[model samples]
Target: MRMMVAGLAMMPADAQDIEPDGPDIVVTAGKPLRVDAKLLRAAQRRFAEDRPAHAPRATLRFELWRGYSRISATDVGLALTDGAGGQLPVTIDGDGRVVFATLPAGRWFLTAPAQSQGMHLRPIVLSSGTSVEDRRLGDLRAQCRVMVAMAKADASLLAMPLIGMFDAIGGCASKRFGFYHPVEHPLASATATGAGVMRTLRLSVTSTSYEAPLSDRNLPNDARVRLAYR
Candidate 1:
């Protein structure tokens, strides 16, 4: 099967990246805050209605940095290792965010691939009604970029719209670029250039499999890309 990869390149020139809007505040350890039972029950009902069934949810936000500039870190691979030695792979969304909707309450160690920098790798404890947001992952040089593929038949119809969608949500400029794949003969990869300051990037794709290589790492042999149909 011939698949056409659509590269979404976000240059630093066109759009400015966004930063956290407010000051960073630390939550200090203190006496347990009390909540009224009526309010707690109402809130629980609302949360259950909005979230997946029977799973505790949490949010993690990542910020990428290159020296003094903040860049978008999208398409980066994240994994949560639980106490039982099981690992759950999660993808950072276009907004440099990941939501854990089905993770059970426990201790988890969050980590990125070896090629990633500026991420938190420490153990985090999660419980019901708790979430971690706007946590600084650390500073990382620009390494990973975004790439996607579609059936060659749908390339023309889907290309521009996909690019625009990425730009609108990721807050980066989208363009086409070239990349070479070893076994695939020719692979398309997008490279962003010209130093446009961007704060976040969002890349979305409907595919059975996708892989983002760590910086300075070769593409893996088992990378698979299959179109996902609804």
Candidate 2:
């Protein structure tokens, strides 16, 4: 089967890449502050022979939302790695989607977190003779859950809209689409004490795209994006 390989986004143009509107923050007094580092990407695999049976491939498409309308991202790219440390270079388009080629069939971990955010993993299983059509909403759902799990695992920072976009694409909107909508509440609040230094970072995630207090509908409003920095 014929598959199209796309590009990925590496960096944001300016500080605007970091959006401040997300889950509520709770800066505690005594919690350990851990620092994170950017992912070190390796070179893409170079194969001498490309056989049809062993040639693996896949495509990733993201419907980026800047409020009600859908938009695309720039310079979005990803690095694929097996558990063994082998890496493959993949590119994404303005829409935050990518079609990759020359992959060997096996279990591989696909991570394409925004440059503004840390690297996130999306495990993909590529079998021989598979094409984009084989990709389904189920695949997107699984990847979304993994992203949320990653954010929860990382106590340093949280990812926004990814969980929500996961909601819309994962078919949380309609059961007629054969997608199961899990019930979860998202809230952002802070607990305070007499000392007033902040204590726990309790943030509930949601799938909402636009900013709250939705007045003055801005055209180029803050789009839903992730952050990866120390």
Candidate 3:
């Protein structure tokens, strides 16, 4: 999509200059219809526009935790939005994770209202008609890995107090990694430091993936999201 906002100037350059060299091969007869560059560009533009039939169906999963424990049946609400904020249908289990199976193909926005203390979101893409049990189990497993990693980080901080503090506060302020302080105010510096470390660990554990949904929604074939706390 065109990346423009107030006061942002588009860079002027020759198309050829911006293009990169890639492998070239000649097309022969007896092959699938070859798409021209212009046609491809048009298709891309259509997808970006969030046109109907370009929306992909997806299943999302949510995993909640309190110190490495999975909490089930927490309230979850999810909706997909196009890049421009158009809503798409989305489904989630009581735990709040969306199944990849149910969504149509297209760009989607998945959101979960903050539930309980320390709830994390893990959004996944599934092809349409994916078996319910398979995706459910898969979501659980993915969340478990994240929980294990968070637990590991928590363990590391217990041994070195000063280093942990520096790692939490100093490291976050510098923006060295995706780490950040969690709470707006820390009752004590140590508490804040620990919270920051926890945030870093959470960010590190979650990731997003794009795959064809089982049912054809006629939307974009892929989706993207990161594990989000907000």
Candidate 4:
């Protein structure tokens, strides 16, 4: 949205020295949101008492969706990994939401299954004394290739290790790519594509083209690559 980085300060420059670039990148701001303060305080207490062994405590509410409709994702198994060798299991509630009460106050990688598709959520940050309540992460319907492409284009999207591994493994037998407008920023899609030498990948909304390489060091030189999207 406004591209607000947590706990970061803004730089100041003289207005006379500034000049316009070719075109300004526009970022749309989302609705203002806040978390439950009481819950956050309790979590901070738990984190302080637990010390090095335990992660901070906080609650997560994942609103599951299918296209534009809200759907129940109860019992869906979610894998949580915090890069620092921490792992946990998170399950959705009967109301299609995930209520995770305790987690570290840092970015995390979330992998889950939605219907017949795989969902990946990365850089899910949980502040030490805050809960993720009103804001929504990226959509679960997005395909791995689309997500991977976004990660490739944006370093912030690379928070998911598995997605990085997918890019590294190379020989892609098949791939599914789909783009969705992030809930937090409805004005734009997660990524934009461009043309290159290899295969062609199109993003419907952006109409941007990008090359899809077929060869990988780990795979045979003649290995075929396939891509799909829903």
Candidate 5:
């Protein structure tokens, strides 16, 4: 059971909470309102977090894909948890989504407690496809829902994409392949504002290789090449 270990990751840069596309306001209600730094920080943290105690809870739905296509994941388990490592009840719904069907609106992550060499915990990693491909078509990085999959009973869990290439030029100029790092990373993450509302986070796990440069040269688009030689 050979598995490709991942390399150092460029944790998909997350989207900072920002005022929706508008500009114009000056210094507020005419007097510098001195806010307690701690309180201010707590307020800002709300955007990325909520409490199950926040009442009525909200819904978080996930649509994980195979790179940039409509094809979806199948036959896998979703391991969800909170910042403290308590398991959050997550499931795959009828719509083929990994969901916290009803959870307190707050920051949620997909990871579990792993005592790997004094390592506190790492996100549960899942690999889709014969070799997951829908995840690497672009530089689009998202982290509202931390990602890692449990696809095989005995599989090597990697922390990041094992290979990366310039999606446009379709070449190995990036030199992202054939590297390994010990760090494990999440697949996706989100702060569900589950105030009886549903938030959807979409992700794609991609693994790609250009066959033209290989010995066969005529492999199918879905060819499963050895990651060691990609």
Candidate 6:
């Protein structure tokens, strides 16, 4: 996938200058994208030419939607525990996410500091499926105008507030952390969304992962989305 028409504003680096420093693969189902920023623009052009035409759908869009922001967490830490009264090993990613490499099929508890100190809920009985996959952009507020977006069919663009906070003029899903990441780290969301590349972290999760459905809602309209998965 390539970057879409979100107004790419980087000083063009000739294609010959790109050195193969990492993997540059198509972001397909169950596959992850890992590419270097230096090679991004050239990749976008390459993919856009070969990309297929969509059936006049809404523009592809990805944004750091203010509607999905979480509440301001106070040193909000998370932990995992096994049912055997034992603690499980866990780690925090750069994005402040609790990651467990492999979870066995057994009852486990995720501990966190919520509203009340004595607050404790039953171990969640879940069916292993998440509809909306949102990975919060960490510390990107200063870079708001620099957001970049790409389309699955090789469309890519940039979101610059210099264009009037044009792409990013709203809020976060939660008000916790201020979202920056418009296009600095290449925050990308195009007028359309397909398997386009954005930042480094290719999505192995979320809406696009399921492929475009018969009735699609991921339209594009220049929303200022923070860079995620980078």
The number of the candidate with the highest TM-score is 4
Alpha carbon RMSD to native, model 5 = 20.2
Per the 3 Å backbone cut-off, how many clashing residue pairs does candidate 6 have?
47
Which stretches in model 6 have alpha-carbon errors above 4 Å? 1-68, 71-74, 115-190, 193-230
Candidate 1 residue-wise lDDT, 1-230, digit = tens:
11223221222322333121111111122321111123212223334442332123422233433222233445545566665777777555554554444453455544445445432111121223422221111100011111221112123565666545543653211232211111111123222111232122222221111222212112221111221222
Once fitted onto the true fold, the runs of candidate 5 whose alpha carbons sit more than 4 angstroms away are 1-61, 70-74, 105-107, 111-230
The numbered model that scores best in lDDT is 4
Clashes of each: 11, 21, 35, 5, 29, 47
Clashes of 2: 21
> Which lDDT tens digits does candidate 3 get at residues 1-230?
11111111111121212211111111233332121222222223323343233233433233333323334533444455556767655544644444334443554444434443244332222335543222322222222223222222323345455335434543212222121112112112111111122111121111111111211122122322122222
Q: Candidate 3's C-alpha lDDT?
A: 0.28
lDDT of 6 by residue, 111-216 (tens): 4433323221110001122112222121111111112222122223342332323233332222221221122122233122333423322211221211111112
Evaluation by TM-score, superior candidate among 4 and 5: 4
Using TM-score as the measure, name the better of candidate 1 and candidate 4.
Answer: 4
Give the per-residue lDDT digits (tens) of candidate 2, residues 46-108: 111211212223223332222222233344344566768877775565335444444555656
Q: Model 5: what TM-score?
A: 0.22
Least accurate 10 contiguous residues by lDDT in model 1: 135-144
Error of 6 at 37 (Å): 35
Regions of model 3 farther than 4 Å from truth:
1-62, 71-74, 94-97, 102-104, 114-118, 122-230
Task: Count backbone overlaps in model 4.
Answer: 5
After superposition, the stretches of candidate 4 with alpha carbons farther than 4 Å from their true spots are 1-60, 84-86, 105-107, 114-230
TM-score of each: 0.24, 0.25, 0.24, 0.26, 0.22, 0.25
Which wins on TM-score, candidate 5 or candidate 6? 6
Residue-by-residue lDDT tens digits, candidate 5, 60-126: 2334332122222234344544456555554665645554334544544443222111111111112
lDDT per residue for candidate 4 within 160-201, as digits (tens), equals: 554455435431222321221222211211221223223332
